[model samples]
Target: MLHPCVVVSGVLLSLAVPTIISMESCEFSGMPGMPGIPGLPGRDGRDGEKGEKGQPGRLWQDKPQKGDQGEPGVMGPSGKRGVVGKPGPKGARGHQGLPGEPGEASHTDATQQSAFSVARGTATMPGRSSLIRFTNVITDFNKDYNTETGHFRCRVQGTYYFVYHASAEEKLCVVLKLENTIVASFCDHVQNHNSRQVSSGGLSVYVRRDQEVWLETGDYRGMTGKPEGYSIFSGFLINAH
Candidate 1:
């Protein structure tokens, strides 16, 4: 009758012998029960494994603190035009100027002394362009020659010379005018009508101011005066414009 497995092993050895004698009779450890109410923040942690690349930082040697003037960059396009230079050296010679205020006395040197010489004191026979009346006055200096209008009045205005000499008996041809323009001529043709002949002439002319100059007779006038000889007329003023 005790074969039910020895009655369950004697009821589990009498309940494990009173729980091992109540944990060996409990000797000290009983007041730690007031820190148990904070447990709800633990669900975000799963990503950490990738780090290896750090070693290259050392080149800033002290001149790297000038960086606050950077806002002016956009204007560059205009450069190429230069080549032309060579011409210098030549200047030296100037100093000699002061000697001028003394020039005002030449109205042709105050009317440059005109001149004349005349002769013809009787026996005249002038006709045909007539005007040969030189009534004797040897040298009329500045009297401008005019023994009663045989004309020569050109006060002073240039080169003049004029000359004449006549003494005739039968055919003479004279002429030396200026206002009617003829300039020079003289002839004497006396084939012995009791003999006498002399006709001379000269000229230079360029007279102008009152302008007259004269001595005419073209178609033969037979001029022979003063003791039957000597007839003269002259003019002077060489240069005086």
Candidate 2:
């Protein structure tokens, strides 16, 4: 039973020298065939040591059915700066926005002044109520009127305009106060006939902050002899409510 060891086309061609095919009356032996010429295809071995890492690829749902989305894969060489990924989850508070449409009216803040004062030389208010001491400052501009305390301080709160003038050799009267409250008056008369009297008056006022305006002479002794500023007092700041 050993002569069948040299099988040719079934790929085992070795051991060709032992020929004893008999086990007590069951077969005949050896030597009578002639078709032996086809043996040349045997040299491609040695690539078999990489089989231990094949089990980690079957975990995407044991996947074998998803085979059509694979044509976008040739751009993969820019991946080395990936460590800053922990701050992205706080964004939801935006909806109270609809009240913005009223802008264009701003006035008053350059010190807020437009003032005036006079009486630079010849003055005479010598009979009792005397505060008409505007030594001369034709426009105090935010100095708020303090010509040696003739007084007009109302640093800014609204509508003001004041004016005054007086001259009388025989009679005169003047009044214009805003803190003690008399707001405006002036008078001149020639009852006895020296006849060069003049008087003036002006007032348009709402004035609030600090509040103190002036000009007082009422019994009237004004001669106004030289008459440069002409015994006058003036004021301004007409709109700052």
TM-score of each: 0.25, 0.25
Candidate 2 residues lying further than 4 Å off, grouped into runs, are 1-108, 120-135, 142-158, 170-187, 193-200, 205-230, 238-241
The per-residue C-alpha lDDT of model 2 at residue 231 equals 62
lDDT of 2 by residue, 1-241 (tens): 4355444533432332222233553675889899999999999998988666655555466547776776777887897897888999999999999999999999846876666666635554455577667676766776888877778888788998887765665666778888888877777766765456667788798989988888777776564635543666787887888
Name the lDDT of candidate 2. Answer: 0.71
Candidate 1 is scored at a TM of 0.25
lDDT assessment of candidate 1: 0.84
Q: Which 10 consecutive positions of candidate 2 have the poorest summed lDDT?
A: 12-21
Model 1, span 132-159: residue lDDT tens: 8988888988788888887988988899
In every candidate, how many clashes are there?
A: 0, 0
